[model samples]
Target: MATFIALVSALLVSSVYSAKALSSNYYDHTCPQAESMVSRTVKKAMLSDKTVPAALLRMHFHDCFIRVTPFCLAFLLGCDASVLLNSTSKNQAEKDGPPNISLHAFYVIDIAKEEIEASCPGVVSCADILAFAARDAVSLSGGPTWDVPKGRLDGRISKANDTLQLPFPTFNISQLQQSFAQRGLSLDDLVALSEFAASLQSVCPMHNKVKNAGANMDTTPVAFDNGYFELLLQGKSLFSSDQALLTNPKTKALVSKYACSQEEFEKAFVKAMIRMSSITGGEEIRRHCRVVR
Candidate 1:
């Protein structure tokens, strides 16, 4: 684990990306209604279905994890709707992969995209919509909200094999750290985002046969509190990856701190998310999310 962290630190310095292209007001001039439209759509979706918050949040993570940064141009996949593309006879899309089989909440993005198209007509990109919806989802679900920098361009490619880049549910602390580090995230960012996994267990169950079967990822799974870190302290974690935090003295100390400090957790989480939102550079806005314009 020591070696892995060291390697990740080196990679972070060498692979650091410039988030110069994105801005909080990227859409203010072209489509002032974009962000509010996405927020409204997400709120409506979550209101209609309580699971929307968790699902949307998961979808964003899955998108970001594929390339470590959703808008990263180095890798083909990002927050683009490529993940939503259906599998063809010749090739499978990311959604068809076994690991992504449980990935839901595409309809929510569709709804937001459609509405935005009607209002702004080919102005907002699917990549930006994803970032916005994700932020709103977390905020509505009792989590922190961060200003998402926009102006990300959607890519045309969507491949199933690329989904494999994501960390496995069984990844150990070292593996998890390496994965996040590849995306330019630090160990503290890993700990901060760990709380988001609190609701993941119920969506992705242990037993294949009982897919829907699950207990809360923590005592207060419904709330975006420090319950996840609290559960870790008690030796109760939904995934091996979550439990692995305790095996490392540093991460374990972070878990203890976040468990007791809501303000601290929220601050770190917001910072990490802001960093994640910077993966995509300046790209064109797609008229349609699923297909690049």
Candidate 2:
């Protein structure tokens, strides 16, 4: 009985030590130190206000519309070249530049992260990197400061089906509410999530010019601001998706609030943005976040 007890004790000690060693490695490999180094370089590029990298815009193209509910990761962006090359006519390809929808937003977030990964070498979670990048993008567009929580795990799958879940440029506010609801999010979540609009640059023109209006979402078209809501107040929103805020009485009240003050939107946007970030790794963010220590 003493021999048996001694053997068990040795195994337990060994197991604990092994776990400690593995955790240390993961902690360092996914540490902010490495990511911060890369973030610093990215900041230099921004502080100088240099022309942004095309790669940064390209990161979001592949996973724009993925939802938090039925997880899918369908390839939605960055297929322009292939689509064009395979097109039957020159005009046909030019009319459409390989679209899976405008992933311009996601691309910017990914680019910032790529810079960090290059500097740190597997030390930061892309999920955390993306969260920070989003905050940066919003700041670049003139949004408020929000701290990004670190230590999120990276996910492994890169499914394309999930991409289909994101809202479309043409979706009305009703549809948007339903979409968010599908993900277990509330209508309030939709409004708050839309606050990220302040950080966006003009949206890519939809293939159909008639549909491209108001799709930009941001008033600055370059900086983040409450211009979107003001536009709503003026009844000048560019797309039904946006205009619906003013048109629907239930949602219209919120539009009036956003129109009345940027402060209102910012307050709501940050809280919701945090929630959206927390939904990581269903598909769009999985390959970047879900990394468990």
Candidate 3:
């Protein structure tokens, strides 16, 4: 386990030191209001549906993770907003994939895109919009805020099969590490981002036929905090992947640290999110987030 962590740390350092293609102020001149427009849309949506934050945050994670190519062992156009594409008569999109079937709150992105389009025309990309929306979702839910680096392009290809590449809730420690490492993410990144996994669990336990019945990610489900980690330590997490964190001493230590300090959790989460969302792919910026230009 120590050797594996060392290897991942080395890879993470190399990836971090590489030249960055995205920038926090990429839209300063072209669309100064891009971030605010997304934030406003998220805030408005949350007012009516408290689940909006978790949905958007999960959407961004799905978007980024599905872009990992197995053979290449690297992220290919990850976080390109391909997940926002809609299924057409000829083909299904990532949004309609088996794994993403439960993904909701896409309307929030559509509304934000429409508003940004009205104000800045075609200057902003849907990928950047989703990124900003995810950031806003966290901040508004009592999580920390960080400036999202923009300049991501929306991928035209969004295959339903691609989402199958995503990590599953049943993944063990080894499987989870390989999944994250394939996308250039380290164990630290995995531990920091695992908080979002709480939202991925089924609203109801398996085999329960209760309609419209569900479960909260934590006691304060609507708020983004270290509560997930705290709950995980208590063995309250619903997913096998969540419980897998405890199987490893290093990751278990991280879970404990985060549970003890919300400040540290927020700091690590922001850095992990920035790094994860920075994996870019796509060729063109679509006028509509659901369709290619």
Candidate that would win on lDDT: 3
Using TM-score, give the best candidate's number.
3
Model 1, 124: alpha-carbon shift in Å? 1.0
Query: 162-234, model 2: which lDDT tens digit per residue?
Result: 4444566688766776655443455565665554442243332223222223334234324556777766677
Residue 283 of candidate 1: its Cα lDDT?
49
Give the clash count for each candidate.
Answer: 1, 31, 1
lDDT of 1 at 249: 89
Flag regions of model 3 displaced more than 4 Å: 1-20, 73-75, 199-221
**What is candidate 1's local distance difference test score?**
0.72
Provide the lDDT at 234 for model 1. Answer: 95
**What lDDT tens digits, residue by residue, belong to model 1 across residues 83-200?**
6556767777778877789877788888888989888887888878888988998887668888898877766666778888888879998888777776777778888887876754
Better of 2 and 3 by lDDT: 3
Per-residue error for 239 in candidate 2, Å, reads 1.8
Q: What's model 1's lDDT at 254?
A: 92
RMSD of each: 4.9, 13.9, 4.6
